[model samples]
Target chain A: MTNVLVLFGAVIFPFVVGYILISRVPQLLHTPLMSGANAISGITIIGAMLIAGREGGNFGYLLGMIAVVFATINVVGGFLVTDRMLQMFKKKGNKNPQE
Target chain B: MEISLSAIGFAHLLAAGLFVLGLRFLSSPTTARRGNMLAAIAMLIAIVATFLDRQIVDFTSILLAIAIGTIIGAFSARLVKMTSMPQMVAIFNGFGGGASALVALAEFQRLSVQAQLPLPVTVTTLLSVLIGAVTFSGSMVAFGKLQGLMHGAPITSRLQKWLNIFLLLVVLVLMFLIIGSAPSHALFVILTVVALIFGVALVIPVGGADMPVVISLLNSFSGLAACATGFVVGNNILMFAGALVGAAGLILTQIMCKAMNRSLARIFIPRQAIQAEKALHDASGGVSESSAAKSDNKPQIDPLAAAVQTLSAAKSVIFVPGYGMALAQAQFKVVELANLLEKKGATVNFAVHPIAGRMPGHMHVLLAEAEVDYDKLREMDSINPEFKNTDAVIVVGACDVINPSATEVENTPISGMPILAARDAKSIIVCNYDDKPGYSGVENPIYQDAKTICLWGDAKDTISQLITSFSG
Candidate 1:
């Protein structure tokens, strides 16, 4: 139980601190912040695979399976999304059209 | 009991730490890539640690599930195009929300089958399940709209608002039924379906411009539902991370909403449903037809030599970027030009508008990706005072947001819209394609200003040229 508490510590501490810092900054950086944070969500899939495999109750395994699937799609598709979004500019050769 | 649950917990801790570093890096577009890579490494290590755990006796299902998902994930990543990225994000996010909802629902079923459910546990689980399902479905609908599988800005009338209000009322009723009496299987499914429909109803009427905020808000709801589920399951780490995501996502959503000068409640109001009614009463007026047509002409520039002379003599330079920069993908070249100018020790700070790009803080991320120093980026209010102090202001790929005329033009569609006043700067250089209208389709009178020089071209090409001219 204490170990669980400590495990809780790792996840909770950073989130709290991060939430505070980001909240204080100007709101304008939110999109970039979100895009950057999305990469970590991809990492979450990797985490899901390990925990789900180890905690193999039939129920846990199934739930884990779904989590792994969704998180993976999030990660890979997310990166692709970010990359594609960046490509919109290179697709067109212009300085700043429409002043 | 769970194979040194403490040690593995530490590993998760380390992974979460990596997530923090990654998130921190994400805060600035400049360090976003490094942040992403670091988080990926952390995630890989987390997988290895989890794999090493002795909790699971059988690995067969694990291997199969991973293999299938990996293949599917990899293929989708390869196939999704840049234009479709927003829709992909919406779809993937919906899945994340849906998975959490499913987990909660399954847990409830298991408890129900045993005929042994704790009172508090059942309530939280039901709450999570319904919210999660709704978020997932709603996100999918949003994706459809953004992808143009549905129309971009399908403005209906006041019925949209009434429906949204009615849905909220229904959600409250469902909550009461779930909490007061243990819901039967049919009721549970109905509750889930209604919530999902409510999610769709919530997003259906919003204009295309509001997608960024809508996406962020749905992300928050998904996180909140996950946190609620974590609580029901007695998983502390899951609860913590879920809460973190929920809170941060909500805050981000609020900021995004504010950037658009909108309130979260207003997003629910569905004014578009009343569009026809308002049109009949108000004679169907908003955008001026004449001004929209005025933006089509090719922009003319002042002499290059004279413009260069003006900039060379200026003491301070603040470059204001809008969606145009993102559309142009000119952050790298913009940074290069800034660096070139900074070599001469001209104080160059990026004046970022709150709603400058397609999303909130869009330009910051783009600039950060180019490795611009963090200190150089200033928000609208921060840079506003300095615009008076600055010698030259460069308006890049910006639209009416920079137009000085909008501040006073009450009759104009964008009248009273706050913008960076390049017209206010001593010598202003407007670097955009031409007089072509922006996304909102309005003309900028700032272009016709005596001091404003319009540098007409695509931003990337033009900035590169500007850099070359400087380098030579």
Candidate 2:
């Protein structure tokens, strides 16, 4: 019963909240926003970590290792790319002194 | 190394809160970077907590994988140009989905081999594999279309719709077989392969012009896949984060579709139906106004000389760029031109259409990379009224957005779509490679307006030539 309740909460609650939040975003920032959201979707990194950390033998280790690599790429690549894109939106007059 | 389950759960709850806060920050440009960082940090916490689990048996392989993934991710993120950002996002989305599918498969194999698979785990595992396979393959197709590795036109046949439905049903049946009785690994493998094929089929019919919507939709699919994987693994934080991404992506997809005055269903309509619809609309005189205007003889000006003369005399000018500017790799030159025009005493501004380039905000990012001031970039609503009083409008390689048919014609594909009011300017100068119609396949009557001067050549070359003439 708890699992079912969590499942419903996870699916429905976030969707409503996320829709309201995302609707407020300006069209100008849509691409960066999508990329940012993509970065967070790399939440699968948690599952991959579990698989890799589990004592389920060699095949599990192989699959877990591959999953970790791919999820890490999604996490690192998605966030960094979004940051790079957002940096371009800085006003021309106010140059950031720090790289 | 043995952390209490409640402690891990508490950490996950904290991480989920951070994810929500990150998404909230992403709603605005000023706070977007920090939002991304917050999410990244949350992911780091989740991964670290997972690593500390007592079940971990090996460290070397895990470290090796992390190293390889970081190097590849960081390098690609650093090196990929802003113009190819969409394709890179597609690739990353594909990787996420593929990872989820692999994780699910590994868990299923482990459970089934030990004959300890629970019903909920089996159902979620099958779902994870199905959605993951589709997202992985569908994103690859989207990436291919965006990168020119595959044709951008819709590939379709009369049987395409039925075939996709049939394929989906077959995969479902195979999934049921795997879950119903003594779980057959062979049935699961075949289902995964079939689901992958169905994914490819699903994306192939979507035309190139609709790729932004497809990319957004695929991003949502990847999130859903992750959510299913979370269920299989019983990870609440993963489930929550996946739900967040799924919802956010779907909302973005809807926004993109709305911007284009299209629906998700319309995008899936077979290519033949779309072509026929266009033909039917055209035959009913929906395009007659533009076609009639096209028959008029508008003078073809030497764009370089005309641009030089008009720009020199203009008090205010609006430069509207489209996908053509991106394709020409001429954003830097465009910025340079805007600067020169400013130097010549013209008040120069850029009119950005919401859906001007291949993706939302595509043009803004391109211009921003060229160091164009954010304040100078005007959205469609803000700039439309300025066109009438503007001295000149310089359209560099943009077509459909500036096409008067969008407003003047009826029953056409882009009839009711909002466009830049470049036609209201005193003089309009267009620099395009040719007189080719834009993505909508509608003849742009804006080219034939008496006040308009069409310059046929490469946008970069023409713009450069104009710069030289102006300077000389």
The lDDT values for all models are 0.64, 0.82
B275-345 per-residue lDDT for model 1 (tens digits): 42333223223333453343444344334554676677877898988767766778788888787778787
Residue pairs in steric clash, candidate 2? A53-B56
TM-score (C-alpha) between model 2 and the true structure: 0.92
Which numbered prediction scores highest in TM-score against the true structure?
A: 2
TM-score of each: 0.74, 0.92
Off by over 4 Å in 1: A1-18, A25-29, A39-64, A75-99, B6-58, B71-91, B144-150, B268-318, B328-349, B367-377, B389-394, B403-418, B427-472
DockQ category of candidate 2: medium
The clash numbers for all candidates, in the given order, read: 25, 1
lDDT for position B261 in model 2: 77
